[model samples]
Target: MPTTTGMKGGGYYDANSREQRSASQIFLPWLEAAIADLPEPPPHQQSWNLLDIGSSEGANAIYTTERLITALRENSDLPIWALFDDLPTNDFNQMFLNLFPTGKSVIPANDVYTAAIGGSAFGRLVPPASLHVATTFNAIGFFETRPIAVLPGFILPMRPNPQAPREGVQVSEDELIPFQKQAHQDLCHFYRARAAELAPGGKLLVQIFGRNETHSTGHGICDVLSDALLDFVEADMLPRFFYENFIFPASYRNTAELIAPIESERELASAFRIEQVEARDVPVPFNDAFTANEDRAAWAKSYTGFLRAFTEPVLAAALPDGLPQENTIEKIYHRIDRLLQDYPDRYEFHFISIATLLTRL
Candidate 1:
């Protein structure tokens, strides 16, 4: 297995992450509700600390936090420290560029100090009970570590795409059960860490790509990527071993899986009260535009760019070091683009996310 590097860096992720940004709009109302009942800061604290974990490249996360901080400012005139956290390998420079463009703060008024912290999202990064409000949007679906060695048949463990058929590449429940368990364990770790960091009566909002009864975020996208790689293997351009060893280390959990730890674990149950838990589908901007204009070429490029922005870094890492890595990766993406253009409706993407708002007890 390849080492876990973060998303594509140096402004690439920020440029192509429209789907993620659009999906996060659902959190605005939930965030307002959380802020409406936010508790006062501790006596010793000088500044209100708001933490954003899994903050990728910064366009989406910054937009969300700006609104959150602005809303918080309306209630009180306390100094706010907005902190962004992500993996060490993430594009922090690019994120800082986005946050502090023109060398000005994200929120110019009201003592708002913006900073970045580099680390894993699964562990505690701040002092105990220091955070007043915390959020993670369109992140946390990724496991901190790869749970299983090799996903034998499919690129992702989610239910196979009914639209893109793979005759021999079906994942059974037996294979899927362990993956689900790992996802549950990861969610537990995340909540445990957040529970420790949040102050008494603090609000924590976690929203990530997830599955519902009707749709999953990974269904069509992963299937298409899997098919594109298989085409290269059949043409003798790539080795068979590459396909077997490559597995995306992320899982989309259902609402039951999202809330199971809070209900089952004694520690979590004692520490927090669930304010809301729900899963819903959000509109895909590129897909909607495609529907409106009926422009196949434009749709293919936009959709493929979004897919490559998130998946390409990991895909590049999975390749053998000796082979022309850049060219091979480009070929794969190009193949995907051609495939999407040829059969525009074959692989359609639907965005569904599970969200939970919790209050520390």
Candidate 2:
């Protein structure tokens, strides 16, 4: 598999999973915060017209829409209209079916439509200055690799070296920095395009896993994997295999790192202003049964499954050769299982969710 420098694949959440649901739980409170900040609807407009960009499976969209409906109904205002949009590949129809089955009122008046779009296709689907609010939950950070879409640069130093196999193709630290920078730049393009699509008064709310400045010490299991891979590359031992088998398939940024490109892009333009930026720690409580049973097998399975599904494929594709299709996945699974047994504490993952409300200037 040849690695692509740009956004190459959809993440795991694209398919519904329990971990995805768990991760999304963090956004419930954030959604409430965003709705509370919304300006009062105009006197004549019957309801708010909302656009949910990158609405994967429409979970967040449905949840937010329902909440807005409750708020509006309490005020005796008309119902709200919501448009759920995503890549054409997303199952918007199914999402609608699931959320609106038999008129549950997840969407008041149920005026929902699906707008399928590409990275460059947003302008065509949304009318200029038409939406009251636009939200993108855990999406919109991905950007295409083309030069026109390149984001600004940033340095992500590799973790300290680990033991190496000691032969074959070597990796250079200098090269990885550029790769990391390009990744950041690409993400900026996606966010800027999203910002451009919003109406003047319309707000764009984005939620994504971000790097925590306080916690990013390259010590977590994810960090250890990165370190081990970089060491393999530097040692020139199975570098190609490492890239093909691991990095490309499972790479991701911490909250701070993910936010850098967006903030950089904002600084370069005055067209959109960020209204709020915040981060909070989310801890998942695991009972004694969760830890004691199956040698943490269930926990490991759930954690790695989510990581592999959402984070791996893209990174795998981005590598020089990408993940091998043969028995490689099975091997990788076993390798992760072993690692989990060795490092149970590292498996206690801490995620940073960043919420930004951007208004068109």
Candidate 3:
């Protein structure tokens, strides 16, 4: 499988295909519920306009449009305009074009100029006070941190501290605190900027990843490995290797931590009101056929492609100069493979996520 070396945001989304699938399932139901709560469409202005932020491959956009159309078919005059926006690096335009070759039911608009979290207004794609609704799935959380490790190759001059022992590189309390503060600031900026574009009475639905206190068997192994890797860095066992190879460079914030930034954003305070906030534990089950036949090996290999893409480079850059890249890769693969092999019957992966429905006041 191809790695995330050239992608933006350190290829965080590139890992774990299951994560995307899980997000899709979770968001679809929430969206349906939100739409149902809205006032009935006006007879003269039966049209609805939707903007999807961080629409990676446009699959979610397409799926959402399809569901809305099905639900509102009684109003034949109701027209839907769907806009899929993402970073310029994302192939959203191509994905939309391919999916809607005829361009009959779907209108594809690209809003790539704005940053994921915040930036200039999207005046070109969305006129002032024109959008009826906006939705983001698993995207808003990214603004919490600006993966510093993924900076351009030219900016690679700042190497990891070398004074630490071979076992791990020591990161001072000073360094860690600043990093956390910056991440919080970035997240607040993102929410405030997003709140500005929303039209009064419009709805914004967001679902994002969050940190939880509990850990599960499916995720425990990977979490332990992540902790071990961090330990190695603190000991200076391999400073450069640790910095380069860590995939999930940013940490997940718990529900309270995630809510604080949005609630405190100055721009969002006056215009947007939180309508509904819901939290749930969703466990994704692997396909029954794959597990029934005991083809756990294939499932693990397929799933690990995303995991490796996310973690390999980060791990490689953080290890000591002497650690072989190929060996580390093999070790990660073998560890995951063994886990799957040992527990072939069922592997339940749980995600604790928040769904917030914000209405423009």
Q: Pick the candidate with the highest TM-score.
A: 1
TM-score of each: 0.97, 0.66, 0.65
Candidate 3 ranges with C-alpha deviation above 4 Å? 1-18, 36-47, 72-76, 101-127, 143-176, 216-240, 243-247, 287-295, 306-349
lDDT of each: 0.85, 0.50, 0.50
Residue 292 accuracy (lDDT) in model 3: 68
For candidate 2, the per-residue lDDT at 323 reads 35
lDDT ranking, high to low: 1, 3, 2
Worst 10 residues of 1 by lDDT: 1-10
Q: For candidate 1, give the lDDT.
A: 0.85
Query: Residues 1-361, candidate 2, lDDT per residue (tens digit)?
Result: 1222222123334342443334445655554555555666566665577776666565545666566456445544545566776665555555666566795644544444433333232234465555667666655434333222211111123332233122432345654665566557655655566555555556666665544555422224354344344444555533444343443211245655545655565452465666666665544333233655645776666555645554444544434544334444344555665566566665456555556666666
RMSD of each: 1.6, 6.3, 8.1
Residue clash pairs of candidate 1: none
Instruction: Write the residue-wise lDDT of candidate 3 on 1-361 in tens digits.
Output: 1112212233233334455456545756655665655555456654666677666555445566556545444334456666666655555444555465586435333321111221211223355555567776655544343444332111111222221122332334444454466556655655555565555677777666554556322243243344344444455543544444444443344556555665776566677777766655654444443556657776666445545544555455444556534475466556656655555433334456666777777
After TM-score superposition, the amount by which residue 338's alpha carbon in candidate 3 deviates from its true location, in angstroms, is: 5.2
> Which residue segments of model 2 deviate by more than 4 Å?
1-47, 72-76, 91-97, 100-125, 146-184, 216-269, 285-295, 315-327, 346-348
- Among these predictions, the greatest lDDT belongs to 1
**Per-residue CA lDDT of candidate 1, range 195-283, in tens?**
89999999988888988998889977887799898998888788878888788778888888888999999999998999998887988
